[model samples]
Target chain A: MGKKIVLTSGKGGVGKTTVTANLGIALSMLSKKVALVDGDIGLNNLDVVMMVENKIVYDIGDIAEGRCRTKQALIQDDCFPSLFTLPSAKTMDNSRIPPRVFVSIVNELNQDFDYVLIDCPAGIDEGFHRAVAGADEALVVTTPHISAVRDADKVVSLLSTYCMKAVGLVVNRLKGNLVTEGATMDAPDIAKLLRVPLKGAIPEDEEINLSSQISKCKDKSSARLAYLLLASYVDGKDTKVFDCASDYRGFFKKLQRVFR
Target chain B: MLKNNTILRLKRILLSDKVNMPSGLIQLLKKDLLKLFDSYFDIKEESLKIEIDSNADGEYDVSIKGVSERIKSPRFMR
Candidate 1:
């Protein structure tokens, strides 16, 4: 059995799905058997983000309700041979899932995969509870915004209450310009506010949205680098914290040399 | 109910912590408050006071006087 990790945020649109998709790809690239479980029932987006929407014949709701076997709901990624997806049902409401059922599902996945990554829906509601029920650890995703940080704090508290073995944070959509201008929160600030160790930070990247929308993950974009670093951390590797300003400087320096 | 121990632990962590309401909730509250008092006042939702400042004396004071145009400054005759 492998570790089960839930990626969650209390606020919506903080890139939980994006993190889950890219992390699955990154882990699979490292030769790990990874499964991304979409826990956002009635509003499934992981499949779309992963560009496997048409391949999903069954979903988590089906398995939870005994409509289909758990294995029957698993969808393999077209791009990565080791990556799989257990998509959430777009038609079913989140209330249909009992906490025990979700836990059982995660335990079953743990038996077959190196990692079971649950992409939780936003809010501290039933979906959030179901997503984290059987996880070995959690990654609380937040943005630089104060509201997102506050919600992330609540999530950290909830995870602590459950006595989860490991709970780290991933701050997504960070703007380097804003951080330098002192107009936005930085990784250290978020870590202090949430009182959790930082897993990784993803800078604001337009390419992430573009690539995901086009179903392409081959781009060596900042978002991809962020995901790779996050996966490396999860796999017990110590990747340095991404310094966005320094990264920009190196990129521009290389560009200038190339042009010269 | 959250247990006494849990509450105490939460108090230790959250004591004197001031959490501002989300912009969405703040907007909704401003709209509701305006609707309730719209007959007598004009209100600016963005300027509305939504935070309660906690003092070292353990007393929290909520200021809502700055939210509306109806609130007038005390006139002083020089």
Candidate 2:
């Protein structure tokens, strides 16, 4: 079986889908066969972000219901050969498929792919329960807000109850300027509150939003860099956490400060 | 904003990667305990302290003080 990972957060609109899409792409770029599963059920957006919204004919619900085979539902990415997506059903509600069935599907997919990344739905409801079922690890996504952090704390406590060994955090849509200006919580604050080891922090990048909307890829953007670093870390490569506060300040200025 | 920042910074330093009980939960527990023993004794919510020891063995100790005269009398126990 392959690595089954669930990316989840308790709060909504915190970019869970965005992280799932880009991280799948990033993992594929590292030469791993990746299957991105959209676990949001009725409100699927991973396919849209991957630019394969029009390509999905069969979804996870179809396979779960025995209407189609797993391979029949898998959508191959046009840009990344190693990447595939199991889009969630738009018509079905979150509770239509049982959590046990979702676990079995992930277990089956794990045999074929190197990484099965489940893009979990927001909230601590049935959708979230189904998303994290039978996953090998979890990536708890959160923003720098107090509510998001509190929600993440709840999720982390849940993960602990499930006895999941590997759990890390990814702070998304972080603005360095906001942190420096005292308008936002820093990464350390989030890590402390969430009680998880820090995995990566995705900087607030305008290009990521633009690219997702226009369906045109951009190069070496902040989000891309963050995703790449996250993928490398997941692949067991040693990578430093991106220092948003210092990185926003030019590298030369940071270097000068270090030397001085 | 500066005050908020300072509070956040202090929280980051003091409570990093630690799960402390939320104040709301503490208050709720206090309220429930007060209601349970309201007739026998006066439960002082403000004087109750819940502490978890940091040693190898995970043990929690709850200390409640400020008992009323009725509960303090030796004849009341037996």
Candidate 3:
């Protein structure tokens, strides 16, 4: 069976879906068959991030209601044939989907893909419970902001109750210049505060914000590199963390920073 | 300077009892426990109290205190 990992953030708008989409594609780039499942239910939008929203016909609700086969609901990525996404129901209520049903769906996906990445909805409510029902591991995503890190701390404590096989952290939207100038918390420090191992740290990049509209990030973007590094770690190949502050540390960069 | 302040504030927030215990959740837990314990013991609903604490390792330490006047008959046990 493949590994089932849920990407979650206790607070919303922390780039959980973006990380799921990009990480899924990166895993596919590594030649691993990956599945992305949107667990957001009524507010589902992983399809939009993956740029397969138009192709989705049968959603997770359809599969649970026996209206469609599991394979019928999975939409293959156009750019990466190895990556497939199962979109959540845009109209279905989250409470209507039982945790066991989501578990079974993820179990089914595990048989076909090397990695099953579930994009968890924000907050520790019914949606959160259902999203994490079948996962062996969790990746908590947070920004460098204090509020985001505080929410992440609560999430880490809650995940401990779930007895997850492993819990990792992904720090997103890290402003490199702010960290180098001591204006904001560092990504690794946030991970340390949450007591979760740092799996990835993505520097703040406009490419990521644009990737949502364009369906894929530029190949040369630093966000893409960080995601690839994260994927390599997930694949058990490497442990090198991306240096988010590297660009702003040099003497010449400091001069540029003054003008920036 | 700002990062250090953030770290200090986060430590205080994480260490606070409100964040760790969440009184509202504990109330709900007590309600359920009351129902379960009432099956075998003659105890008042308000008699149950639960305390939860997280240590340095992030592990929860939970303790429940209650008083029961007597146990129900074996025939009534469920």
Candidate 4:
């Protein structure tokens, strides 16, 4: 059976959905069959991030309520045929799918894919528990900001009670310039503070933001490379993360930073 | 300096009761403690205090203290 992992953040807008979509594609590119599940039932957006919003005929709610089969709810990706997405219902009603049902759905997906990535909703409420109930491992995503870090810490503390196989941290939107200037904590420091293993550090990139909002693809970027490394790390490979502060040091680089 | 200050502030915030335990949970704990203490002595509900302090190892130290008016009449062995 495949491993089921949940991508979660205690605070919103930390790139959980974006990481889920891109990392799913990245893992698929690595010749792994990956399935992305939009666990944010009320505020579903993973379908949009994967650019498969128009193709979702049945959602997770249908599968949970026995309205349709699991295969009917899954949308196969066009670019990466090995990747599939199970989008959440667009309406807000937490009672439709209990935590145990969500667990069963993900367990069913585990039989087929190599990795099942669940894009969890923001905050530590019912939605968070529902998403986490099915996962064998968890990836807590947070930005470098103090608020986000603190929230991630609380989440780590809570996850300890669940006895998950593994819980790692992904520092998203890390500002390389700020880290270089000593204005903020970097990925390692943030991970250390939270007392969780660092899975990946995704730098703040405009290309990532643009690709998440629009259905446009871009060439190789720092965030994409970081996600590739993260995928490998999740696949049980010891990979060295690419440096995010490489472009903010030295004389010529300082000039380039000032220009951009 | 900003990074250090943020780390320090975050440490303080994490130790706060708002993050460690919600107000509702604290209230329930207080109620349960009051009931347990009432069986032994007269507990002052208004004076009952629940404190969560941080130890050197960054672990929580919960203290529940109260001033009892008097001990309840002993009838356990009767």
| Per-residue alpha-carbon lDDT of candidate 2 for residues A34-66, written as tens digits (9 for 90 to 100) | 999999999998988888889988999999899
**Every model's TM-score:** 0.74, 0.77, 0.80, 0.80
Q: Let me know the TM-score candidate 3 reaches against the reference structure.
A: 0.80
Model 1 chain B poorest 10 in a row by lDDT: B1-10
lDDT of 2 by residue, B5-42 (tens): 54444443323335464545545766777776565665
Each candidate's chain B TM-score? 0.39, 0.45, 0.65, 0.66
Report how closely model 2 matches the true complex, as a DockQ value: 0.13
User: How many clashes show up in model 2?
Assistant: 2
**What ranking emerges by TM-score with the best candidate at the front?**
3, 4, 2, 1
Tell me the spans in candidate 4 whose CA falls farther than 4 Å from its real position: A213-218, A252-260, B17-78
Looking at candidate 2 chain A, the ten consecutive residues that score lowest on lDDT are A212-221
Task: List candidate 2 stretches off by more than 4 Å.
Answer: A213-217, A250-260, B1-78
User: Distance from true position, residue A241, model 2, in Å?
Assistant: 1.5
Query: In model 1, which regions exceed 4 Å deviation?
Result: A213-219, A248-260, B1-78
Which structure among the candidates has the greatest DockQ?
3
lDDT of all predictions:
0.77, 0.78, 0.86, 0.84
What DockQ values do the models have? 0.04, 0.13, 0.58, 0.52
* Candidate 4 C-alpha lDDT tens digits along A1-260: 99899998899988899988888887887899999999998899999888888897899999988899998999998878999999999984887899999999999999999999999999999999999999989999999888888789889988988889999999988888888888988888888777788989888888878776212444456677887888889887865665688788788987976776
- Which has the better DockQ: candidate 2, or candidate 4? 4
